[model samples]
Target: MTVENTLELEHLEHPDHDVVVAGGGPVGLMLACELRLGGARVAVLERRTDIDPTLKAGGINQTTAEALYRRGLLPRAAEAQERRLAEYREALAALGGGRLTVPPKFAGHFAGIPLSAELLDAADPAFDGAGPAGEVGAVLQQDVERILGERAEELGVDVRRGVELTGFDAGADAVEAYTSAGRLRTGWLVGCDGGRSLVRKHAGFAFPGTDPEITGRQAVAEMTGTEGLRYGWNRTEHGTYAFGPMPGRFLTVEFDGPPADREAPVTREELEESLRRVSGADVRIQAVHSATRFTDNARQADRYRAGRVLLAGDAAHVHSPFGGQGLNLGIGDAMNLGWKLAAVVRGEAPDALLDTYTAERHPLGAWVLRWTRAQIALMRTDPHAGALREIVAELMETVTATTFLVKKISGVWHRYDLPGPGHPLTGRSAPDLALADGTRLADHLHGGRGLLLDLAGDAAVTDPARGYAARVDTRTVPAASPEETAALLVRPDGVVAWATDEPADAKGLEEALSTWFGAAA
Candidate 1:
């Protein structure tokens, strides 16, 4: 069934918006777009009037790539990927690549160690029936934000720029948010406002985790006498440093604890000193273009929701920028929460559906923290850490180890624990299947509604969704393997809610529909 474009048709006592998002970054904008697609009224309150042009998160993992693909924005993502690759090539050409060594097949890195693309198993089960989104895409953070922000505008999301969310009071019915612009009423509030989230703080969520033990600095500058630095990531005796993946981009990690003042300006002298300390190359900085400071200070909210308030992205969890998992993880959170929240607001599903957000995402968030912490362990400047790093590096050269690590780094191996599974595909991401109509399964899901695919080609298989015609769409898909899966019930976020290898069972299908899409008509 097709959804209407109408908005804000709730009762008279309904709040001004269904949801008020506290940040207008990529994750926030993505969530707003998802909410709008699910037919919810959403408003994004952003503090910055202009997009920050800082160089951060130069690529997205496979999971995030798939999310964009399912949303019909794959072409834009492809353009962004091509642009990033062209820029990388141009930068390398300017560097005059003669003696400088770089990895031949760079897929990704783990704690500065290169994970080769050649080592990945092409026949991995994770790639079975996967589409173009199974691969990673190189796109900057600002580029991702720009893409999502434009999509949000087109979707009719009310984005208020230069207006910060100061505080809010969450009541039983709705949340009254006090913003820099003024007070507003929203049924729910989500904190996507980065690490220093006022919504998370005002909601009194317990944020507990490890403190910073390293100060990391990244800069793009014009410099002279920098031939001594390595082309890619390098572990030095003092700290770690990487150069030239992008023209003058330089990064240094020092184990001298966190910075004294995180908000302090990054000067050319400071960057030059860091390069010397890590590379011992005596390089001189000619001009600084863009620079930023970071730390490995990791923390996670004890719970993601409090009453009518919730958190996502950096507001929900934060860690070191070691593997570039922050943005991908946040995108995953938005994709997971957006549909459920919208359903609850529309009174289609009970509020209990929202509880599953914490149950499913908290474990993944904890795992990311552990993943980054392990990298920190391998990055320390101690002799023991050096020995461990050497052993790990040797192991990483093997195909088995590289394949395992790449899967983790690419974010393609995640599987949720949904209730009452029927097939192995249950609770996993639904693969993009080639439909009989020459379209793909992802094409049917662009509207942000649940999907019931009748692989058995039986009319009875589509009957369970009759009660939920508005919330779930039914399709007759040409099953690639009827022996493996005869029917599939997919959530709006692309997660498989239920699957059946045997013939389609109406009882099981109805249970899944009621579980995820509320009581049947």
Candidate 2:
């Protein structure tokens, strides 16, 4: 039975919203949009009065790109990416001299070790039918937030900025959130409030992980004597430093430890000291524009959900920003939780479905923690770490190892361990299939509803989903390729719930539909 149907009369009549998202950043905004698309009333509470323009993640991996594309926002994301790339190019041209040469095909890096994109295999099974979703994006964190925020507005999400969620009390039926503005009741409370999540902590969620071992800083500054510093990532005798994707941008990593005062503002003296120590250069900084500090500190919540309060993005997991995984991981978390939570709130699914969020994403989040920890081990200035770095660099030079690392970094190598028939595609992100009608699979997902595609033109395959019309959109289209599956059930988040290589299985299709979409309407 739906939670709303089982709730007491007063509880049903008094709850203010279906879901109230704490923190209106990209993750919260994305989740708010998804909930609206699922026909749920959502409100987003953001602490900041204005968007934070601090320089953060400069790109989105394949998984995040696909999430945007599925919502018809890929074009906007691509435009933002191109604009940033042009600015970077213009900055480099201003330097005139060939101090740094951009690689023709740079995939990404691990432990500051650049991975060449030229080695990626076109025929790799991981990307067989990924289509446009395989493209990585170059948008910054601010741009990402802008894109999601705009979409959230278009979807009629009630976003309240300058309002902070101080604390909340979750009862048997609903959660009463006490914010800086006032108190509001909600069926669910989601903490996308970043690493220092008040919702997660207030809900008594346990957070456990290692402490910081390194202090890293990045900034855009006006400086002199930068010529003495090497281009790109350089691991010197003391620590690591990198110069210029843009002319004035500088980054330094010192292994002594995390900064004594992480909240302290960046100063000209501090930047000069770090640059001199890492590069052994006599660089003098005249002015500092934008700067941020980070550390190797890593942690993840023991669970993503605690009763009616749940967590996403940095609230659920956090690690060193190595491999540009922090933003991508958070985006993945929102996309995974969005539809499921909406289903439960809309009274279309049971709360048991919410448990699947942690089950599926916890393993992946743990893997990311381990992945960043490995980079820290390689980045340490110790002799043992130096030796290990050399070995890893040699392995990265090979096509096989490069391809493997690329898969993991691109966020396309994992799958949800869903219960279904033993089909290779089940539990994996659905391929962007090219239908005979000239539309792709992503075109049908813009409305945030589950999909049932009948490629074999069988009445039985399409008939089983008739009862689920409220939550599933069924389409009978000719197979785009001879080897395409006869039928497939794709969840709203673009995961394949079931697929059949042979003739359509009516009973199996019905069961799969019932399992994921709840009993027929």
278-365: candidate 2 lDDT, tens digit per residue = 9998898988888888998899999999999999999998899989999999889988999999899888899999999999999999
**What C-alpha lDDT values do all the predictions have?**
0.87, 0.87
lDDT of 1 by residue, 332-442 (tens): 999999999999999998899999999999999999999999999999989999999999999999988988888888877899988875568888889888766778888
- State the lDDT at 338 in candidate 2: 93
Give lDDT for model 2.
Answer: 0.87
**Counting only residues 3 or more apart in sequence or on different chains, how many pairs clash (N, Cα, C under 3 Å) in candidate 2?**
0
- How many steric overlaps are in each model, in order? 0, 0
